[model samples]
Target: MASLKERITRLQSSALFRGMTRESLEPLAKILNEESHKAGTVLMDMNAPGDKVYIIEKGRVRVSRVTSYGEETTLQELTAGDIVGELAPLDGHMRSAKVTVTEDAVMFAVSGEEFEQLLKSNHDVSYNLLRELGDRLRRANDNIISRLEEQRVNIEGRMLRLHKLTEASKSINSTLDLDKLLTRILEAATSSLDADRGTVYLVDDIKKELWSKVLQGSNMAEIRLPIGKGIAGVVAETGETINIPDVYQDKRFNRDFDKKTGYRTRSMLCMPMKNKDGKIIGVFQLLNRTDGAFTKDDEEFIDALSAHASVAVENARVAQEMVQNERLSAIGRMASTIIHDIKNPMSTLRVYAQVMKRKSGNEEAGKLADEMIHQVDRFVNMTQEILDFTKGVSSLNIVDLEFGEIMNSVLDFIQQDLEKHNVKLLRETQFKGMVKMDQDKMVRVFYNIASNARDAMPNGGSLTVRTNEAKGYVNIEFVDSGTGMPDEVKKRIFEPFMTYGKKHGTGLGMAIVKKVVDDHKGRIEIDSEMGKGTTIRILLPAA
Candidate 1:
């Protein structure tokens, strides 16, 4: 058993009671009741009224509850620096859990009446205990509420999926066109599953391969994958839903992909994409579910999502085939017209050149004829560009493209024009990365933007071109210190018929720029202030 002086010393040592003035706890010290109990003695029982609370001075006590079946569950074991029975006194309720002596224990007990008397005299101690009790209750309640909210959110998500699937089914049944159907399917799959990124991979069962057919995401730039690899491969081989909460931690996750692109794989939920006959046609993988792991609810939702997607993909394929046939017919007609137009002009130019060579009398006439021929050639090139732009003929021919090298070529191509216009070209080529793209198409995208900058700064202000790496993408910035466009002009700058200056300009340059960016699966952002300058920012995926 602890002596009165020893009990006082123990209480004084605790951080909770040490801050009180000596005068404030004088009554508590003088009236402190020291009691000793053997091990296994019940100090406080469950359902008992709370009249007194105990502060352990020495040894230990087990606070526990006995169930109806006589099983004991220990709530807490009280040792030195421990207080029990505060919960009930603070709430004016019965003791909730039993406190028993687990070891020979010495304690100081304070009755409710004495505690009230102490509180009336020592307001600081009373207020401090009240605050601590209140904080504990509030924290417990907050934890309960947070868990309830999570459950409610999960339930609501399931209901929303059912509603979305109903609408998606109706839309899928009504669509037969392949491109439009694919767009709808991807949009639905992305939304219904609540995934940050969703992709449809067509499986060639014979070849045992998976190829990305369609993808959608807020941050999605481009898709590059081969079959029999990674999470998608797991789905393909097992024909089961593979829910990988952390792909990076999974031993089966192929890091070869991360090596290829500088992007890391996080979470993935992959399921087999099947057709109407329940035949596995491909694998569908969704990455980084926005909320958490693809829960049971998500799996159900994705099952429905995949059902609609599979049908739409097949229908779209058929529709696309038909569209291709029609496109070929139209191209054949356009080719004939182009041949006639091109050959007739070339024949006349050849005849004129021969006449000039044979006659050799009028030098000015010959010079004028030669200049006219050159103009005709330029017109032909411009016509071809217009044809390519209007037809949306993206170059499928891929090459290892060094971005800095191509940017240098573009800068060189526009250097002479910049000199003619007295524009100071500034190049900040900090990026040294590569991409798989068509060289011609990439050059065209840059050329269009740079040329527009030159035209904007005709009076010889500086034009700045910069390149750098961004969040999983490469960014190129083109800034021109020109008489910037007004809000009205800037609003329509990318339109096919919008031109800021030069009466003879075709106004298709920016429009073509937009097309090239779309072809590269990239984004363009334009920022301009009237009378300040304009900046065009382009973001493309890095290889």
Candidate 2:
């Protein structure tokens, strides 16, 4: 125990006691006892009676709790000029924690009874403690509120970005043009994420290559990279998203693109473009975030853009395929017409050689006579058809003939052929008027249609040729109980070499009839239904 004067000297040196005026602190200072503690000495055992309050005068004291593992974690370390055990003095409760002197320490201690008596008398001291407690509580509350507000802002920002991305994906899926769709993707991606640069690469899986389709930024056109060689390639190969805060330090970053474009890379975000099947179609790479490096929000938005791009690219390919089909159909028709012309002349030459061989006898006159007859026979059979085709009805002598007379000539030529096949012909010739037209072309038209009618009724069916006059025109109709056509076939029937019954045609007969009719300023209509029958109606002007 020390004298009251010595105790006062120690207390006066302490910050806790110094907060009071010299006269006011004098009483509490004299009541305090100076106690010396050694290292490893327990100052207070947990849950023990709280008798005294302590003010550390020298050395240090540690306040700690025993953890579940029986290890001690120091909550606070009190050094000289520090106050402890003050909270315990406010209430006569068992100590909630144990206190130990970590090093040799000298502290001034006062009893809880003395603390209570001093608290009742010193209103100014009590008021100061109350204010300190209130300040700590208010500060704790403010800290909690600030953290919660920050969390809420983060959540809201993510939701807004998600909604915009969903809307953009929907818009991109609605178009089929590759260029337009890719342009929309760039605009939507950059705007949605508030990114500074964006580019979409279309993957050529077959070639194992990635090609840029749309590139946009402040100076985005400057950057270019090859597949399997850069950040874009990593994302494309692994089908993962990559975000690098600093491209300069990353070993995976290739500087060739920077060297070529003269654009330095600071940060990069890249994602793989995948189709519905999770097949990597391409890559989308963004460079140098304007504000800060791209975060998780940017990786998510790039994924959305890539998904929509895959569908758009597929649709464009389908449109291109359809166009190609139409072009091929046209070419087939032209080839068939050329073949028909060449074959006719060859047939005439073969016939002439056969005829000449049959007429040949031994040597001179007999052989000459035989050769002349054979050559004439061959010439008649071969050149006859070729001559008729090349020198069409336009060069034939014109004649004023009744429409029924032309129909009867064509009907007569096919009558025997039809009877042999057990086919029926129903002729309803109503036109009795005359028309000035090429007689040969008119014969060719009727002959070709009648012949086609015979071929169509392979199992022997009815054929009807009906004639009528309507609106200053003569109309002739051919109805055959033959396999009809679908809409697609019907539209293309007039096109040369477009044939349905493959085993029975060179596909040129109807085409020839169509051309002749067209040349004569005639209109022809065909109506047919699959498995039902076909009706061919030819209309010509009446003179």
Candidate 1's displacement at residue 346, Å, is 5.0
Deviation in Å, model 1, residue 405 alpha carbon:
22
Q: What C-alpha lDDT do the candidate models reach, one value each?
A: 0.73, 0.72
lDDT of 1: 0.73
- Look at candidate 2 and give me any clashing residue pairs: 348-382, 351-378, 352-378, 355-374, 356-374, 359-370
Tell me each candidate's RMSD, in Å, in order. Answer: 18.9, 23.7
Q: What is the C-alpha lDDT profile of model 2 across 326-410, one tens digit per residue?
A: 4444444444454456566655665665555566554565555554554444434333433343334234445667777667766
Q: Pick the candidate with the highest lDDT.
A: 1
RMSD in angstroms between candidate 2 and the native structure over all alpha carbons:
23.7
Return the lDDT, model 2, position 473: 88
Which segments of candidate 1 are over 4 A away from where they belong? Answer: 1-166, 173-229, 233-240, 244-249, 252-268, 275-282, 286-307, 317-332, 341-346, 361-543
TM-score of each: 0.35, 0.40
